[model samples]
Target chain A: MSAIATPLAREPVLSLRGVNKRFGAVQALTDVHIDVAAGEVVALVGDNGAGKSTLVKVIAGVYQPDSGDIRFSGINVTVGGPGEAQALGIATVFQDLALCDNLDVVANLFLGREDLAGGLLNEVKMEKEAWRLLRTLSAKIPSVRIPIAALSGGQRQTVAIARSLVGDPKVVMLDEPTAALGVAQTAEVLNMIERLREHGLGVILISHNMADVQAVADRIVVLRLGRNAAEFRVEEATTDQLVAAITGASDNVVAARAERRRTDGAEAQLEEGNSDG
Target chain B: MADTEQTHTVADDLADERLIRVQGLSGLVHMTWNRLRSGELGSLPVVVGLVVISILFYAMEPRFLSSRSLVSITQFAAPIGIIALGIVLVLLLGQIDLSVGSVSGLAAAGMAVLVVRHGYSELVGIMAALTVGLLIGAVYAVLHNRLGVPSFVFSLAGLLGFQGLLLYVLGRQGTINLPSGSFLVEFTRFKFVTGLTSYVLVLAVVAVFLATQLWGIRTRTRAGLSAPGQGAVLIKVGLLAVGLLVLTWYVNLDRGWSYLWLFFVFLVVVMDLLLRRTRWGRHVFAVGGNEEAARRSGVKVGRIYFTVFASCSMLAAVGGLLAAGLQTSVSQASGTTDTNLTAIAAAVIGGTSLFGGRGSAYSAMLGIIVLQAIQSGLNMVGVDSSVRFMVTGGVLLLAVAIDSVSRRARSSSGRG
Candidate 1:
């Protein structure tokens, strides 16, 4: 059930408050608070091992937060396990995609949730549903019966994202869905993210590609050293600002040394644009 | 295929989904070529290997392909074939039951002792032996789930421990002869379907296969989903019928078709259906393919592992019982000598991937036959166990190497 009483739809679909996680001596995440409203796309960006994945896992219920209150639809809920997280209408497409290569597209699409008729797999119905899902995304898969091993990276990603829809979740978290994808495939995935937004579902996109993030994300949340570094409105934030936040360039020794050069570089870019005009 | 969408009457826009149904003979051929080029070998390698090996063996020894030789070879494959089915299921999950050989032997030993020494009826003794298998499986599952002991280690322990238990139960005799008039012995030894019955059964199989295929096409087509054409269905059903009839005729040429071997094949077929056409089978492949993914998807990983391990042991028990029935006795070497290697080798050779989530139940049948043929042919050529063991091991390696190489070829070709 969603909180639909508010006409403005400003209430966050999912909100994390002071969440913290530790793996022994290493604090993977700390005091991480992020919120997403319905129909909003939130981009999570971080360098390698900045705890973006750890935070995603916590939200997805793969790892329970050490101390935090996770509120979904303005209600506090305990994410004890992935099952509970899924039951709470949060669907996650992890970084690995997690598809069985030996199984065909239909099998992969309906892995845990298969429709059975008379105690046997209703392949006909499932296959039909599979085609419908693929068509909705305009996915160009050749066949639904071929094993997942035969699918391209884009098709596999589509299958994983489409599988998440089988549950019709409110919050959809995609962990680097465009990683290792070609240009066209990346565009296809971006279109899917926009589609999720159009469907009035909260979309969480975790990515390393700044171009992809700035292209589709409404708001970007950057993580640095297990903490929230900065948040930016996509319309106003410059690439340099995003990069500065990601690399913590404000106080970095090398970044400070290049600060005057950065200003000069910006003026030089304006002169170049003037000459071009 | 896209053109067909337009040509075909529009029943529902929702049902008008795209399927790569290549029409005409050439298009079908083109599709198959694409699959083969991508390393979707399926039973191709086994069929080719069977032919090559059969020819080479026949050239070396004229009696290699004789009907009588084939009969004995098939009989030899029955028990291991049944055992290999369990291996296929376990391998699909990327797990193993190293204790299967010992488990089977223990079951036979237990059955013989209870029936011959304690004078229990054969049925009760057999059930008791199978129940022991179930309990042993549960123990393995518990050790795996609760103690965090890996299946390989636990089954390794079971292998040694079960073999010791078998020896201890025999109590210095080390062997027990099954009763001659016992139903178990008699049934396994002389039970064969008459040729008439076998042909009828083959017809029934063909009929059911065709009916299902037609029904599937009808359902999908009616639902506005793309379905295989009637032409393709007929072709597939035709090939299957011809293959079954040829196999039935070949086996019947000997001592008719053994009902026991049919039973083994039946189990494999049923398991194939369960693995391919049921939700549980999909879960098995999912859990085996990626345990973490399966868990995140809400699949009960522990339960899947438990059921596979338990069913594997149960099948091993039945395989052991069949072996005992074949010899009419349980001995120290009943499950000892070559059963373990042969059964595992059969599975691998039949194109089942050792890496898991990539095997079929029917591979058990194909792989076992190839293995038994090698052993039988080597016997005909006066090759001793030294050569037999070496050859079998070499063949297993070859199969695995081929599997890996083809997998690489597939990846390089951008199939994944």
Candidate 2:
């Protein structure tokens, strides 16, 4: 039991410092610094092109940072591809999830890493393990034998999460985990993330839903114009303050008011054009 | 109050136990029905098509369903069926292998040159043929995987290249007849039992294999593993039994039965096991489903592509060898256009989804039978060869269109 760290107060499990990524002429990410401690959930929020995806891609090994360094477990690491990241116990569940819906839940969970015995796939072992994993996450489905196509969006998300944990990954990054789920399903997925944190795994969550971030995120890192704008502890910030920080108007009340005035002016012009037409 | 409490406790216990029993039972039933409805149970359309064709052929000529005709059909279907099995794998991965017909021709030519011209042993000739097929397949796979070429183009090139090689090998010798020998005559010509008995033997083998598979699945489920529902298993076995029984009955109608069809079925089963039970097989499925995802998952995607191409070529070679054995001769005109088109059509018609990641070897066998039946039926009805080609082409188009449409629907529904 001592071998497993508690879900609080630990060294940074993964840290990215001064990371920058440029694609051709445009810089997708700039000077991004984020750290996820053991058992901590870090929510990364930004506008449409705020580099949320680029940042996650860098950590997931989809893109290599042109500058800055990545440190995992206090050791500087070079991640060439997703495989390398996986080897380092970093699992990223993208929006697509990369699951074969034609296959049953167990088959999807053990897609490439099926258990083998006597030179044959040990279906029994794989099935049992799948069951155990689901049980641990407290994912309730009718049966684990059903194809993923038959599952709801929430269940499918659960399956993807289970697949990521198959190798017992240290860092689990989920992109819009509840974006397609209903109210109940969103709650279920949030609960699962809480459970993952309780197990002492560092979680990086990318979401547009402020409510979700406030509910689950321990630390909220706001990105504005491809750079870190502000970092807030959930207890120290209100919804208005977070929104202000994201919109780049947290420091000046007059600027925030002016920006609102400009938005209203644009809306009035659109309405005037509609009436004239 | 104590009596009331005891009654309440008893009711609660009964309800709990009943719920467990009911869940288990419903799970089994639900799974079985699902399997039955899915194309996994062997598409009903294919089965009905075969039956309808058989009846029509029988009506045209009473002897068409006789023992001799049945034997002939099996012998014809054997080589084609073997090739179709390989096509099934390619199809399951959502690809095509157009080189099989030419690969088969090249293999037969190679075998003939080795054994008859080079004065090599029959075993050496067969080995040479198989090796050549495998090498050709490997090259195609590499080109597709490493170079990122579509399988269709890679195999199309193989088709042309191998066919040219076959013509080159034959040279001035337009035909080569295999020498009649004990091994050749016994294995190719001998019948283990007469008429109905032979069909029974074939059916028995199929039943045993299916039973073993079902038992294995059950044990996995009982061990708390995630296995397809018992209902699905039963439905699968039931469909297989019905199919084999019908085929046997048809062949047994005549007093003579050929073991050639059984051999073809065996080949299909072996290929199925290779794809389902082996690491190589899983890799092929993965590569087909999403090559990028599979590569990210640490699979040697390039190697799998290469291996699958090689396997298809090898199967093509085996088909050619069997065809030569049945005819006792390899001719210049052997393995014409029908060979390639029919094999692809058979795989698609048999329920090997053109979209990949969801098909079986048995589908190939069903597809082959359907195509052959169409050819044979049309000929018996006095339809010209030209018209037959057009009909087959149309059917192939329809099958492909349906497959693609269904795949799109499934994906859009967020099922895939």
Candidate 3:
């Protein structure tokens, strides 16, 4: 199993080669090479501003990278915008979800691409498709016709995921799928990710929770200082090793721990000062 | 070694999550129902004011409930009600159409000229009037959408400009008396089924509406579409039916039914269908809800804006034609300043939210009935016209206050 986990073993559905993204003078992403293969769950993890978001946005076609090539199914493609990316079967579920709160789940699911019949919206057809998507995801919501405002946090996430699958995308990227959820809700979302993999879909799950990553991820990729720092199979990696790789302290871990202690002390002092005023 | 335990844990967690979500949705529905039953339907205060005004009118004249007086009230309300319908659409999109009065005036003038001055047939004249009104509306929509100007400013400008153009069209003639025996008069006067017949028709139409809504809910539920619970759907339909029956009983007590009122009601229902069931209607709601979001969703927001403005103008034209039929003439002073404000007030008072994405054309009828009832009732009791303005303004303010308060409550309860 470990021998077959190498990059050369499987063809990648989406691949980014040495992508570099800069915002004016700040380099947001540098020399990032990542690949998402079909039927695989790749966990992208990093601390804040480590270029994880930048890399995902590039793949989602929100921004054009300053340099590097993006390949889709082995064909080099230039994705112009979100619409173009959607056409190419690449769906990104942003943290905000981009859902209309006033609209019901069915309406939101078929919002831009509603089914039509006889020059009018075929409500029946859209409703059927929305139901199918929800059922396939094993979403336990009571009904799909209720407004999103009435949905719980986890159900809302399910709707967002279902929306992404509506276009039958080759890749689905979830940004912080369980960020604000409670324990049970997190587990539900994890189950959903597993279902997506079972359906032979490529998924890129971005999260700050190590527990969540361990539960769902097949492979773990760490980003540090806008660069790929380390890659490891979830079965062979431990939480401590992953932490060390993320913080650039894998070698001489004890000295790195001492330095982190000093920084924590200064950060706490600054936070206290701000709160006091 | 831990696979079985993990699977069991996952199953338990999924069940718990489902329970929480179900609880949340039920709570939301319960809160919304409580608010609606408590008279927090956006214009609760105005509705109360209407009831008070009716009571006062009844006290002044026992004849207020008489069939003849009731007929007069509905007759006067017909044209204004039609205009109010258009206003409701604009308000639903969180917009205003100030040009309705002018659009009405121009349409009346055009119809009169085409029939009386140009010696054309009345049917041709009516068609021409509607077409012209639609054209004007389209132009306004284009201007508003393409230029990205606020609807109020452009529509206000249209009010003045169109009024001037109407006066020009009616040049030298000032007022043109319509032929009494013409098709326009016959069409307006045409009444199918007398008193009981009218009441029955109204009831039937209301029944059809309720049935369709219920059927839609049931079909959606069967398809596993997200729908309100069966109880909620039943409650909504029951409330709507009761309201419709009450209004029908009142209107039918007097003159059976005003053909004019029925015509306007038909127009409003068609417009509602256009907004709620069609692609164009969906686009309008989307643009109104969040312009940026709608644009990103691939809707041509600009084109929708144009279409809304144009449709509003067309509705105004229809109102104008109706007014001309009632008066049997087109006058230069046909559309007063009060006309525009009253139409807008009717929409707002009919439960159409000023915040957009939440209203219906039925609001126009409700709003116009409330306002016109007050006007006619006051006239019967010999109240000064000036005092009527103060009362209407007061009602408007009270409605707005109720709207704001209810909105706050909805948001706080996490149900809005």
Best by DockQ: 1
DockQ of each: 0.42, 0.28, 0.21
Indicate whether candidate 1 or candidate 3 has the larger TM-score.
1
lDDT digits (tens) for residues B289-340 of candidate 2: 7776676667787777666777778888888888887778887766766788
Candidate fnat values, all: 0.58, 0.34, 0.25
Q: Return the lDDT, model 3, position B303.
A: 75
| TM-score for candidate 1, residues paired by index | 0.89
Considering the true interface contacts (CA pairs under 8 Å between chains A and B), give the fraction that model 3 also has. 0.25
- Over the stretch B146-242, how does candidate 1's per-residue lDDT look in tens digits? 8989778998899899999989888888889998888777767888875789889989999999998888878877887767778888989999999
Residue A159 lDDT in candidate 3: 92
**What fraction of native interface contacts does model 1 preserve?**
0.58
Better of 1 and 3 by DockQ: 1
TM-score of 2: 0.83
By summed lDDT, the worst window of 10 consecutive residues in model 3 chain B runs over B11-20
Candidate 1 ranges beyond 4 A from true positions: A1-9, A17-33, A46-51, A65-69, A222-230, A240-277, B1-21, B57-64, B246-250, B381-383
Model 1: lDDT of residue A135: 68
TM-score winner: 1
Q: Which stretches of candidate 3 lie over 4 Å from their true place?
A: A1-5, A17-33, A44-58, A61-70, A74-81, A116-132, A138-143, A178-191, A206-216, A220-277, B1-50, B189-255
Q: What is the TM-score of candidate 3?
A: 0.80
Q: Scored by Cα lDDT, where does model 1 land?
A: 0.86
